[model samples]
Each structure stands twice: as structure tokens, then as C-alpha cells.
Target chain A: MSLASAPPVRARAVLPGFRLTFGTTLLYLTVIVLIPIIALVIEGAGIGPARLWDIVSAPRTRAALRITITAAAVATVINAVYGLLMAWVLVRYRFPGRGLLDALMDIPFALPTAVAGLSLTALYSANGWFGAVLAPMGIQVVYTLGGIILAMSFTSIPFVVRAVQPVLEKLDPALEEAASSLGASGWTTFRRVIFPAIMPAWLGGVTTSFARSLGEFGAVVFIAGNLPFKTEIASLLAYIRLEEYDYEGAAAVALVLMVLALVLLFLSNLVQIRAARYGAVTA
Target chain B: MTRALLIGLAVVTTAIFVVVPLVYIFVQALGAGWSAYAANIMHPLTLHAIWMTTLVAVIVVPVTVAFGIGAAWLLSKFQFRGRGLLITLIELPFSISPIIAGICYLLLYGRQGWLGGFLARHDLDVLFALPGIVMVTMFVTTPFVVREVLPLMQAQGSDQEQAAVTLGASGWQLFRRVTLPNIRWALLYGAVLATARAVGEYGGVAIVSGSIRGKTNTLPLHVELLFNDLNAAGAFAAATVLTMIALVVLVAKTVLEHRR
Candidate 1:
């Protein structure tokens, strides 16, 4: 550790070009990411503080955030559980249509958001086949919160399943078998062994699903019905501002959404990094 | 008993939610009758929408792919400063809603944009123009290639390039002869992902595209327009085409991953 002595062998191996690489990446990212964000902040500043506060603090904005957050939260939870089950089934079992089912989960990934929104709207509109049945029960979907949930769930499902599947694939069944042989119940074995192993991954998936739902516009727009303080979400509100030629208002709302998005991304990345580390240690 | 029940429930969920809706799209399209389908497809507006969408995709895909490869290469190969930050920025678009992406471009290029006066004096059109649509599409889809390829390239180290350099190989020669062969699969995988993203992009393009009936509408916008026009069959038909392309991409990706 002394200056006369050579630096640690590992540090020597890694540190020589590290600063150069780090600097280049910083410049590149600052230009691409920070610049746009700063511009958004600047635009948002145009309205005096009071006006900006009033716009952002409006009851409608509050309600839109409530719908957006609550819907996104509910959808993420639903997908968190179901998406894990789907991933587990695909990874752990052999069955007919397994391949087909595996591929089907990625539909939301490939399908354009607008098309997805349209398809859901079509299928769930009162006259459509599924809606024909549900409408009779008065379980309205299209232009309702239920429809937004369905659309968000459809699109965000893949994030969880994809995140969990790879980890499930590499998991050795021996751990579970060992627990079972030690006289643990099925639930006990799962909770003690398998759950701890995959819990972090599950959480990461949930975070990604939640973050993704926050910014979703294409799929939600059609089914949302865009009713202010009712069906309208934050992204749509920004859009409405733009359409009304309120560039300042649009930028204000967009700035808020962007900040929320950045926070969500930071949280999700932290979860993902932790999940990866947990995965490595468990492996 | 519940274990089997769980599997059964999962199966049903997939069928009811994913499979059935997709099938319904096609069923509705075909049920519209050949004459109706042809009339919708052959309509001048419909044809123009398709042509315009093709033009945008044709322009966006290559430009996106080029950026993807260049950024992926630079990030993967060089131990440059800001490397992690650059990687994150490349992926920033994934988090930003596309509608906001349109606004970002609008801020830079719209009629009231920073460059608007300069471009206006020169008689250049953006904002609601074709270039604006493509630019916004490119912004949304830019990350697909870089995200896909960077990880793969990182996994592959600099050993091969070092070997080529030691042999007195020029840079292009090394990339073409050595690096390209190794990365072709990952590159195509990235390209496919980008193309799917570019084709499916709706919100940002919708905003900047102005949703003009025939001229600026991409497939997704066209579908929305037709759906609004009460042309359910036509909307489903056009959407079904995009769905089929997605299906093909899914199949291809599956096969590629399976082979690997």
C-alpha cells in the first residue's frame, strides 16, 4: 500500500484507462440526456413561479396523477405476480404450446402502442364480441379506468416475465429438493429457498413494470377516453396542452412528467443493479 | 390439484387476453368481405397513408441502425470518459414517453422553436412536415439498436481486434474482416428490434406528423383515423397487417435464439 510499493495488482489492471473512458461517457451522456432535460426545465421556468405552481397544483393535475399512479401501481402488482407465474411455468415445465405461449408474451413488445390501444378498444367496446358479453354484466371497460388497467397490464406484462425468466432458467432445482428432503413443507421450501433467490428479481421486474406504465401513452390514449380529472393521464394532459397551442402549459406538464419519469428510472435502475448482484451472489 | 389449476389459469389468461384478441382482428377483417377490404385498401387516402408510412420507415430504419452501430462500437471498444453516462443516455428514450419526445423536437424545430425563425427565412418546413415525422421517429427508435448491440459487443472483448491489429491490419479491414463476422447476428437482432420499434412508433410521430388524412399518417395513425371514421373493418385490416409483421418478427427472434 505504500507509495514505494506498486499499487494493488487488481487496481493497476483496471485503473489505467478508466478515467478516459469515464470522461468520454460523461460527455456523451450529458449532451444526450442532460441537455434535453435542462431545456425542459428552462421551458417550465417561463411561467412565473406562482403560475407554474397553480398549473401543476390544479385539482385536475392531482386527479390525473392519482389515476396514473394508482392504475400503474395496481397494474404493476397484477403483472408482478402473474408475470412471475408465467415465467416460472415457461422455465420449469414442459407442455404443449409452451413455445407458442413463450413467444406470445412478447406481443406487447412488438405491437405498436396505438395498435394495441385500438385492438383493446375494439375488443372491449360494447358491440364487440367480448364486450358484448361483459356489457350485459355492466362491466364497462372502454373509456373507463378498467380499460386503462387492461391496456397497461397487457403492455407491462412482458417486462416482468422477461426479467424473471432468465434467472429462473439458471436456477438449480437441487436447492428446492434439498429443502424438501430436510422435511420442509412445499410452502416452507418455496419461501425459504426459492423465494429469497428470486425475490430481488421479482422486485426489479415490478419496478420496471411500474416505471413503464407511468409514461405509457399510446395504449392508454384510446381507452382512456381522455376525460379530464377522470380518465385523462399526465402524458395526455401534456398533449392536450400542446393541441390547445399552450406551448408553455404543455412544457410545464411535460417537465413534471419528465421529472417523475427520471425518478422512476433511477429507482428501477437501483433495483436492477441490486437484483443482478443478488443473482450473482446466489449463483 | 391447485398446481394444475394454476397452470390452467395461466393458459386461459394467455388465450383470452393475447390470442383471442389477435384472432378477432383478422376475423373482423375477413368478415368485412373482399369488396369492402379492396375498397378500403384501394382508396386513395388509404394508399397514400401506406406509402407515407413506408417512406418514413424506409428513412428511419437505416438512420437509426447507423447510429446504433456507431454508438455501440464507440461505447463497446473505447475506454472513453463518460462511458456509463453515454450508455444511460442512449437508453433514456425508453423511459421518456414518445409524446414528450415530439415536444422535445418541437422545441427545437417547431414554428416557434429555437431554429424556427432561421429555417422559416430559408423556407424550410418542419414541425408538421415529413422530415419532422422521420426525425421524431428516429428519436424514439434510436436506442433499440444500441441497447441490443452494446451488451453483446461488451460480452465480446477486444481480443479479436487486438489480434488483427497485431497482424498490421487497417481499422476498416479489422472491422470488416474480423469484428463484423462475429457481430452480424447481434447486429441483425438489433436491427429487427429497431425496425419493429420504428414501425410501431405512434405517439411522437402522431404529434409531429399532424395526422393529416392521407399524407402524414403512418400505419398506427391510419388505423386511428379509420377507427374514428367508423370504418372498423378498415382499421382492423390495417392493424392486422402490422400484427402479422410483429408475428413474423416474433417467430424469427425465437428461431434465432433457439439456434443459438
Candidate 2:
């Protein structure tokens, strides 16, 4: 029987310095990133299933996880609806300050998380400007679950906005025209045509925003009020564990957060791929 | 009317959530006027943190760029064994939390760490020192450059370089003349993003730095420390520096996008 032939090896581009550069990249990656992550996984696994269960199932740990998951879900839901609207506005409508608004979208990406937290806290605090307005309406945002979601949304707004904007911009105008010709109302057209076209990308963006909110520390810590079993989050709790010299406990907490982030990243990729599949011709 | 209301909602949400906080930082920093703001920034500890932050950037940016460029060259230019695995491995850092990265290093270098015994025997410090801070910063920002440059190079493919090589150009000549110029914008864009990150990183540096004032404290850490001490003025002033960096990054990004 004839065996199947293997493919030929690809040629090296930087043949002159290939070995040197490749070696340096591998060594640097191993030392700077790979080794430490491996160390964390090792330490986490060494805790064994029983210890891991005990640490995470504890009242405090469970509370932080619950709060973190709930807040992130709320934030993602807010982003899902709001980001769609924002992207539609930016792409479909021509406004006076459109370019300026577009530039402001990147602010969240550039601004340091700690700064975002501080600014949001200032704006939402009782004596702060927005708080003053909202308080008269009997709404208190700061030092509450509302404040946590606000900060997360502030830091992660760009994700959903930027993700959906391009898709909306590149949308086939012919489809909208055809719908109008078919006597579809504006709302009906949006419901049947626009929403379905952009849903996967929109979902992908929200998933990313959700994942980001989970690992958020600087912004959340400042505004979350840090009251255990109430405002405290998983990342902050993990930080506290580290501070207490409970390394194993900290690693356990972090492993759960890492898993959550990885899951979201996986979901984001799947959603993006689904988006691609849905619009093979248009996308 | 629906469009107006929706746009109004978007505008209001951004104004409340995005714009207000940005303006609030400078407003608070200058709450005591300009002179006080300057003094807060010029405080010795603040000075040290700024310098420390700059030092970390100077060291980390180059190393990260080298990693980015090197990795870009290796994984893209040549098809190699385990290339897919290598890419996933390179990208692993982005999925990790900065705090977790610090924890990993701490477990590897802290007083009771794996290397702790050897370091103590050698009288060398790793955790809670400048070295530890640099390491963590490098780890956090490692993926930025690769993420930026690799796609461009791959899309361009090896056709140009193969032509140059066939024309009797040396490897350096091929890279310097053909590759570098082609990838310059993407490379600089990556480096700029990395610089912003290296300067702004807080959580990773905080855990490894031990928060020793004027010694290992970074700019972001200094801002948090000042706030915690009720030194609101000092905190705001220092935050101004970081915000300005963020502003510059935004401007640079705009310019880059316009060029593209």
C-alpha cells in the first residue's frame, strides 16, 4: 500500500537571522509570560479539588462571584441594547458633532482604568453633579450595584460601539431600499433586516464587553465601595486574598476569573464566526 | 421623533458616562488652581514615580517591540512546525489578568517563592523591586506589538521578500529595505499602544512593587496612593499626567487611522 505523502516544509523568510530572532522570541515569551502563567496553573492545581471547592464555596467567595457575575450580566445587557443604538446613530445619521462623537468613542480605550473609576465616582457621588440631579429623583448610583455597572460600562463602552459601528457602516443600503420598496415600515425593516444582519457582531461585542467587566479591577475597586458580600467583586476579592498572604486562596479565586474570561473570549470568537457565516456575501 | 430620542439617549449616556469623568479629573486637579497642581506633580515622590514609570517604559517598550518584531518575523515569514500552537501561546498573555500575572511572578519570586531561596542565597531581589515591576509590565504588554504587526505582515505575505532575496539582497537588506518600511506604521502603532500600556498599568505593577513610596511606586500606583491618603489634590494632579498620556494616545490613534 502506498502511504500518503506529507506536505513540504515552508521556507524561512529571514534565513540570515531566523534562528537568532526565533530563539529570542521563544526565550522571552517563556520567561516573561509562559513561566508565570504555568506557575499560577501549577499552584492552582496543587490546591486539589477539595481545597478548591472549600475556598470557592465559602460564603464570602460565593458572594463575590455572584455579585461579579450579576453585575457583568447587567452591564452586558445594557451594552447590548445601547451599543446597537449608538452604532446605528453613528453610521446611519449625520449629526453636527458626529466626528467629535466618533473620536470620543476611543476615550474608553485610551483612558486608564483608575482614572475612569475616579471620574465616574466623582460624577456619581452624592455631592457630584450627576448624583445631585439623580438624587432628587430618589436615585443613588455611587457605592451601589448601579455604580459598579456604571464604571464597567464606562471602561468598556468602546468595545460594543466600535465592534458594531463598522458592520453598520458597511451594511448594504440596497437591502434597506428594497425593504422600503416592499412597503416595510422603518421599524419593521429594522426588525427584520438590520437587526438580523448585525446581531452576531453585536452579540460578539457585548460578550467581549462582559468578559472585560469581569476582569475589571481599577475602575470597579474605586466605585464598588468594597464592602464584602455586597459591593466586592471577584478580582478585588482575589486581591484581598493575595494581601492576606493566602496565595492558594488568591490563585483559586483568580483561576475562576480566568476561566470566565476564557469562556467569554471563546464565545466572542464563535459569535464573530457566526456573523461571518450569516453574511458570507455581504460581510 | 424616535431617531431624535435615540440619538439623544446616546448623546446623554456618553455625556454622563464618558465625558463627565474625563473632565472631572482635570477639574478636580485644578480645583486648587494651576500652581498647586504643578506642585503636586513636582512632589519628590511623584517625581520619582514619574521617572520610574518612564524608566519602565524605556526598558519595556524596546523589549516588547523586539518580541513583537521577532515573533512577527518568525511566525509569519516562515511556515514552521507548531505555528498554530505558537500563536495561541503568544496570545495567552492577553487573556490573563494583570493581577494574576503579578501573582504568578510572586509565586515564582516572592520571599517564599520557588526562586526565593536561590535569590536569598545570592542576596538578590526580584519581587517588590524594580526588576519585578519591569517583568510584570513586560508580561502585560507583550501581546500588543504582535497583535498589531503580525496581521499586516501576513496579509502582505512573503512575495515581496522572496523577490528581494532572489535579487541577491542580504537578509538584513531584505528586512531593512523591504520589510521594515512596509510594516513601519503597524510597528509604531503597536509600540505606541505598548508605551501607553506600560505607563498606565496599575494592578500588575502594584502587586509586585510592594508600594514602596518614591522607590518602586509607578505613576498609576502613585495616583491611587495619593487618593487613599486623602491627598486628593496630589492624586488628581498625578492623574492629569496619565490622562494627558491617554489623550496623546487618542490623538496619535486618530492620526494613524486617518493615514490608514
**Winning candidate number (lDDT):** 2
lDDT accuracy of residue A150 in candidate 2: 85
Report residue A137 deviation for candidate 1 (angstroms). Answer: 1.6
C-alpha TM-scores of all predictions: 0.92, 0.95
Q: Which residue window of length 10 is worst by lDDT in model 2 chain B? A: B77-86
Task: State the weakest 10-residue window (summed lDDT) of model 1 chain B.
Answer: B78-87
How well does candidate 2 score on lDDT at residue A225? 89
Please provide, for model 1 over B1-260, each residue's C-alpha lDDT reduced to its tens digit, 9 standing for 90 to 100.
65687679889998987888778777787786888877767778777877887788898888767667667666666553454556667778877888888777677667777777899999998778898888777767767776666666666766777767778787668778886787777777777877788888888887888888867788888988888888888888788778887887887778767543
Question: Could you say which candidate leads in DockQ?
Answer: 2
DockQ of 1: 0.37
lDDT of 2 by residue, A1-283 (tens): 0000112225563355678777998899889988888888888889999999999999999999999889988988888787887898898888888887888988877888887887777777888888889999999888899999988877788778888888888888888899999999999999999888877778878888898888888888878889999999988888899899999999999899888888877777677766655662253
Task: Write down the C-alpha DockQ for each prediction.
Answer: 0.37, 0.53
The local distance difference test score of each candidate is 0.77, 0.84
Off by over 4 Å in 1: A1-37, A278-283
Enumerate clash totals for all models, in the order shown: 15, 0
Kindly list the interface RMSD, in angstroms, of each predicted candidate in the order they appear.
Answer: 6.3, 4.5
lDDT agreement of model 1 with the native: 0.77
